[model samples]
Each structure stands twice: as structure tokens, then as C-alpha cells.
Target: MLVTPVDNSEIVAALDAALDGGPAVLPLSADDPRAGELRVAMAPDEPTLPGTAVVVATSGSTGAPKGVELSAAALTASATATHARLGGQGQWLLTLPAHHIAGVQVIVRSLLAGTPPVLRGGQTFATAVASMTGPRRYTSLVPTQLLRLLDDPVGLEALCSLDAVLLGGAATPAPLLDGARAAGVRVSTTYGMSETAGGCVYDGKPLDGVRARLADGVIELSGPVLASGYRRDPGGTAAAFVDGWFRTTDLGLLAADGTLSVLGRADFMINTGGVKVAPAAVEAVLVAQPGVAEVCVVDLPDEEWGQLVAAAVVPVDPARPPSVAALRAAVRARLGGPATPKLVRFTDALPLQGPGKVNRKGVKDMLRGT
Candidate 1:
């Protein structure tokens, strides 16, 4: 299908429709003549960048869209990296929506694997897995999708059939990954964003031709998969790529074994009495408590402490809000003095934006009556 820029959205929708057992119309854009092929427009006067494929979107968590100029080489580099990491691609099962880089990578990797993936149309994970027609199969899922799969035994068994499953999009709660691994699922955690044309790190290690490093606590990446800067935004491009490295806002540490362990975003760190505390760390501990279903830790303004650690949690049972004291005690057991949350407020359900991620700004506003 020759998909013009105007038909990009239609192609994405049609792709999903095809996967869901609906009509498979090869969506073509006004400018393009064929199906399944997309041709994005460029200003005739402006010099085209090195890449053929240009993805325009912000990293969803940050809420700012910038055009990422990518070359076919860069995208192919990412796909090749993924193929090498996954021991050559098996039959891929599509679950995520098209248009996103991760979803796009699935299609490309399937092509690179010399076999089109089995399109599991509009079905749940179990239904999707049951529909595949290959020996060794693989799929990609976000943390939330993985959690939903874990909620049922049948779903768990279905996931176990996959030779490998790439888990990305957001942090995978350790407990959730542990449960999946215990239940016989090969879950490999990945890290990357749209700027890198999807994930470059797989299972804490950078794929071949990918570079992962930390500078001043900010996670930085380089090598083949990095986008050729933002489109028509010199300032944004310059800021995103400095000295040939894309410095991510995420802070992380390189373990002794050379694995990168992300430590949440640097801006999200809460300072209490001049001590820095990681909200993700706090929430990770809180959510492990017996009665907690979900938790979001935010920094609340405090004249004395500058910013106090406050948490808004969703309990498993409304009538069983964990006591503030008990919650504090639980957090303290894992984290020392400054890491404990000063305030614990229970909510019916934590405000969510995008699957599995609690909307920090929205949660703060909900607390402030904004």
C-alpha cells in the first residue's frame, strides 16, 4: 500500500483493523499511489535531512511534540539491533497500536525476519496468542499490558507460549516482572524513546551498535539508532543532541556488570531537608505493601523542608486504607529516614495517563482541587 502522509492515520487504523479480523484495506494517502507504502512530504525549498523516514511526536511522558528526522539506515540499525538481541526474530505477534515507533519496529522486524507476523486482530492477549501460526513466536508489550495479562491464569499461560516478549514503554514493577518470570514467561525489559526510533537497550544491556551511558546522573545514548535531530527546530535539535549524544532526562546508574538501572527522571526528584529522594523508589516500596493497589509519590510544598515527600495511593480495598503510620513504617523498612513519605493520602484510583503510568501533574492538581 502506498500510504501518503495524509493517509498515515488511516494506515495505522487499517493496520489495527486488519489485526482484529476486520477488512484489510491498504490505506493510501492522497499523494501516494500504492498501498502499504508511505511518502511524507518535505518543503521543496528546505534541504531534506539524511533520513527518509521522519517521525513527528513528543516523548509522550513530557507532552512536547518534536519532529524526529530518521534515516532508513537508523531505523534499520534499530531493527537489526533488536534482531541480534532477540537471537533473530521469530514470528512476531502484534498487540500495540501502529504509528508508535515500538509498533513500527514490530512490523520492520517482522519484515527483517523474512516473515510477516501473524496479525491478531482486536483480541485479548490470550486470543491473540492462540491465533499465531508459528513454532517460535515473540511479541512486545508495555508494563500495563503485561500486568493485565498477569491478572488471569489463562492469559499467563498464553504469554508463556512466546519464545520471548519485549517489555517496554515504562518501568516494569519488579514484582510484576518476577511474577511473569516465575509463571514461565521470558520477559526482557527494554529502554528507549521515539528519538531513538524505539528501544535500544534490551534486558539492561545495550544492543550491538547501541551506546548507553550516564553523565551528571542523566542517561545518555548514542550510536546508530539516534535520530538525525528534530525537523525544522534547530534549537530543539541542538538541545537534544549535544556532542553526538542524546541526553535523556532520566537519571540512572551503570551497574558493575555494565547494566543501566534507570533511577527515574532527574526533575522528579524530591528534595527534603536538602536530601534528595527518588519518588519512583518510594512508590516501588509503597506499592509492595499488602493492601496497596497502586501508588504515586509526589513532592508537596513545605516551608520547613522545602519539598516534603507526599504519596497518593489507591488501595486494594476502599475500606482498608493503609494507616499513614503503617505505610511510613513499611517504607522506612526498605528506605532510610529521608526516603520515607511524610504524607499518605488514599484515593479511590490513582489518576492515570497512558497505561500503567500515574499522571503526576494531574494527581497533584487533584490533591490541590485544581
Candidate 2:
């Protein structure tokens, strides 16, 4: 699905055919330099797939090259469950890249609901919402987009007009979530990945038919929404999907009420000396401070501690930013000394990877330079 021009006609047709048990489509961004390599990895030349509908390439981001094979049944289940969870069918606004699973699910939901999505392309938020004709309106966004939009009165109003706003793709700061809801925007925090055909968990609870469990502190998801496993890597599939559950890299705590509180990515934990700390735990404290607009916490190598906690912050006031000592004290006071960032760098904005996700690797590199 080369969506440079936001043309979904061909992609939609392919999806329709796939639903009818046709050849599986490999959705890739035309702008990605890796498209050719990804295409070779997820061979679309196959005449037909017994059950697969789409193969979303999930390489580079994690570790190795592999394709996520989602069956039509899984996609349909996700779309249907989403609609059911969000209180009936509605029009969707495509704000994220079409190649990502989140964006693909928006189109899939629209397709299953028989109501096509309105791509935000180059239009203003108000203009995009005005063009939507569904009785109910909904859109998905990452935390970065939500924070920016909340600062724009028009965007805030446009979001407030929607039936529900799905926020995911990254960890949302407490301030951002509070601000959005305070301004009358119905925000639903989503959790899931391409393995689950998009977000199967919304607002800390699993969608109807979806189940969440913890295996040795790691989050595991199950239900009809799970992908059929990686396309070509059976070993990877076996490692991830065990006993009808898809194991995720995210660590979480499932409450008695079944509400899952994600504790950030297991692989993203920063190890300083002997104690391990979640970057998000420190970010939660730093982001709530007066001058902090956004923050990304990472670990930098150190001769003494082995690893030193570091932070890159985007200040609310660039000229008069919060003092590093004050920020460190705040984190230390709230989360203890090991979680406090020893090195801090201020920037106008955090580097973004996909649509609205902050690029942590890029932030680490920037902090390293300082």
C-alpha cells in the first residue's frame, strides 16, 4: 500500500480480495528506502495464501527482519471488536502513516463498517472533521500528535467534537492525557501491536474477545485478534506465540479488575550499576514539572556505574528552562536516586520516528553528543 498520495482504492481492493481468500497483500510505504528489501522478505509473488490477508513487515525496529502475517479473520475481528467497544460504527480519520498497523486498522475498520475513512492528508483538523459524514467520529493518534494538537485551540476543539480519540504508538505523559480529557476530548489509550492486528486493548482493558495475561512479568495477549505469527520465521513465531498467547516485549501488571498497567518495554529498561529502572518511570516525574513539555529518558555508558541515567527534555519555555538540578531532585524525590538522570539535555522537540512516536535511539544519540 504505497499511500504517498493517500490513495486507498488499490489497497482497499486488495483487502477485499484477500477477505475472499485471494493473495495476501504486503503493505509497504512507497517512501521507505527499505521497501525493496521488505518486499523481498515478505514475498507477495505467491499466487495465494490459505488464510493470510496482510503481511506487515516489522523489521529493524525490533531486532531482525520478519513479517507479521495477519489473517483476514484477525483483522475483521479487530475492526468489529473496535466498533463494538467504541459504541457502534463511525467514520475514522487517518492521521498516521498508512503502512503502520494502526493506520491499516483504521482503513480495515472503515472497510468492515462500510464507511470509508477521511484521510487528513494536508488539510487542517477542522477541515478534515467537517468533511466526515458519519454519525460518530473517531481517530487515532500518538502522544506527540496529541500534545501538539492540545496546544492548538482549533485542533483541540476538533478533537473534542469526535466520538472517541484513540491514543497509542507511544507512552502518553500524564499531563497530556489530563489536558485532553479536561478539554472535553474523549481519549482512549490503546495498547497492542501488529501481532494483534492493531490495538486490542483500550484504556488498560482488553477489547471483548481479547485477553491479557502476564507470564513472568511480561505481557501476553490472546484472542481472535492475534496474527497467525511471523510470515517466514517459524522459530520467531514459536518463540513469541506460545500456547495460544502472543508474548509482547512490554512488561505490565494486571490488576484484580483486569486493568493492565504497562511498565514500559522490557528491552528498554535502563540498567545503572545493579538496579534497573524504567525510563518511563523517570519521564513520568520529569514531564509533570513546570518547564518540561516532553522528556525521553535513556541510559548512557559510564566507567564507574557501568550505565548512567540520562534525559533529553523539550522545555515548555525554551529561554528559561527548568534547572537540571531541580529536575534531578524531582525524579530522585519521586522515584529514588537510581532513576534520577545524571545528565540532562534540552531541545526544542524530541526526534520523531514514525508518525507521532519519539525516536528514543535518536534521543540517545543526541544526549550522547552532550
**Which RMSD values do the candidates have, in order?**
6.1, 2.2
Best by lDDT: 2
The sequence of per-residue lDDT tens digits that candidate 1 reaches over residues 118-194 is: 55665777898887766467898987788778888899999998889999877777777887899899999989887
Q: Rate the local accuracy (lDDT) of all candidates.
A: 0.73, 0.85
lDDT of 2 by residue, 124-165 (tens): 988998899887889999988888888899988898999999
State the displacement of the C-alpha of residue 132, model 2, in Å, after optimal TM-score superposition: 0.3
Q: Model 1 compared with the native: what TM-score?
A: 0.83
Q: Kindly state the number of residue pairs that clash in model 1.
A: 13
lDDT of 2: 0.85
Per-residue error for 308 in candidate 2, Å, reads 0.9
Worst window of 10 by summed lDDT in candidate 1:
34-43
lDDT of 1 at 197: 75
Worst 10 residues of 2 by lDDT: 1-10
